[model samples]
Target: MSAVPISEHVALVTGGARGLGAHIVRAIAAHGGRVVINYRRSADAAHALADEIGDSALVFGADVTDKDAVGVMIDAAAEHFGAPVTTVVNNALPDYSFNGDGRSHADNLTWTELDAQLRGIVGGALNTIQAALPGMRAAGGGRMINIGTNLVQNPVVPYHDYTAAKAALLALTRTLSHDLGPDGITVNMVSGGLLRTTDASAATPDAVFDAIAAATPLRSVTTPAEFADAVLFFLSPWSRAVTGQNLVVDGGLVKN
Candidate 1:
């Protein structure tokens, strides 16, 4: 696809080192926008991707749960990329934990596990959004897209913690939209079902993949690029009037 005309716009994507996050970074940069790729631990991978993207992309490291670090990351991005970060995508997760581990039964789940999940998905989003608000408001308009999951709608697997965290993120998206709407900031969500073969879903069993594909109306798994395209729509002018909504791009896996 040809690049979108996002020249001079700056975008910040958290957890942008690999998997779906990596696709987002490339997508934004390909569209001619400057991107701040945030990574917590994948320094090498982050730098490598940034290098591959050339000058439009820069990698920064920060623990998204740490407000101070998040602030620093945003500030640095603004200084380096001349932000009013017109776009922000929150796609980071704490760790890759599959619900199919068989150890995730309600009886085995712990507050500690739930807490960590919340911090990564919800807390991280709050931190990044809070940091970007000033610039977005100053710019007169912006887009904030949160990465969610279709599991909340039709959870074939019982990934209680992950789904719960994303549900909370959807709530945050609505609240932020109303809170920032008057300021011309739009907040929305792009939720997806089982995406194929990304690092995040690498642990999913072959049988699980087959079942998900069969269950989907499309009878196939979606790609990370396809999911990224949905996110791009939210960032584009076409979605300027769309906010506080969750757009599911899960190949008809969930009709709602």
Candidate 2:
């Protein structure tokens, strides 16, 4: 595809300090967009990545679960960057609640744990979208991409809370797309299976990884960069007509 002209557009990515979020930030910068890297606790890493990327990047520290904090982060990003944010990638997740440890099933999971997970995933997206919408509407157009999971479609290794939250996010994406379409805003989702060896997934066992890979049609695990590519597509003009869709980037692991 021909390069998308993202020059002068400001993009905000939650959880942009490392892993998949970092890759998404880099990809946007590579495509000539200015990026605001948002993180909750990885301030050092966030600043380092922003510094490494030079003036086109800035780091904002905010817990996505907190609406007020998220608004401040978004406002600060717009003030620091020349353009108001016209693109948003909701990739920030709470520390993983699911490992292969088998502790995340419905039986063991408490309502409090489930509520926390849902709030982080669903509430975060809503907060950021609310903060960014006015700027986008004023600018005449924008894109919102919410990161989700393939497990919601095929729950092979069940993490009830995480999957349920992501499923809610997908539903939110569709509803928001319809609600905001008339105002020149688009909402979409990108879902992926277990990515290999990111800091978040480091505790996952080798055998579990192998089993997922074996079951995937591609017979391999995906990388953070590969997942970032899908996010980039949603930001590009090619996907202008696509909204309220969940694009799965799991190497055909869950064919729906």
Best by lDDT: 2
TM-score of 1: 0.94
Candidate 2: tens digits of C-alpha lDDT, residues 1-256: 1223566568999999998899999999988889999999999999999988999998888998888998888889889985678899999997764555755665677888779889999999999999999888888888899999998899887888888899999999999999998877889999998898688787788998899899889999988888888888888887878899999998889875
lDDT of 1 by residue, 144-204 (tens): 8999998899877888888889999999999989998898888999999888878878877
**Alpha carbon RMSD to native, model 1:** 2.6
Clashing pairs in 1: none
- Per-candidate TM-scores read 0.94, 0.94
Give per-residue lDDT, candidate 2, residue 97: 49
Worst 10 residues of 2 by lDDT: 1-10
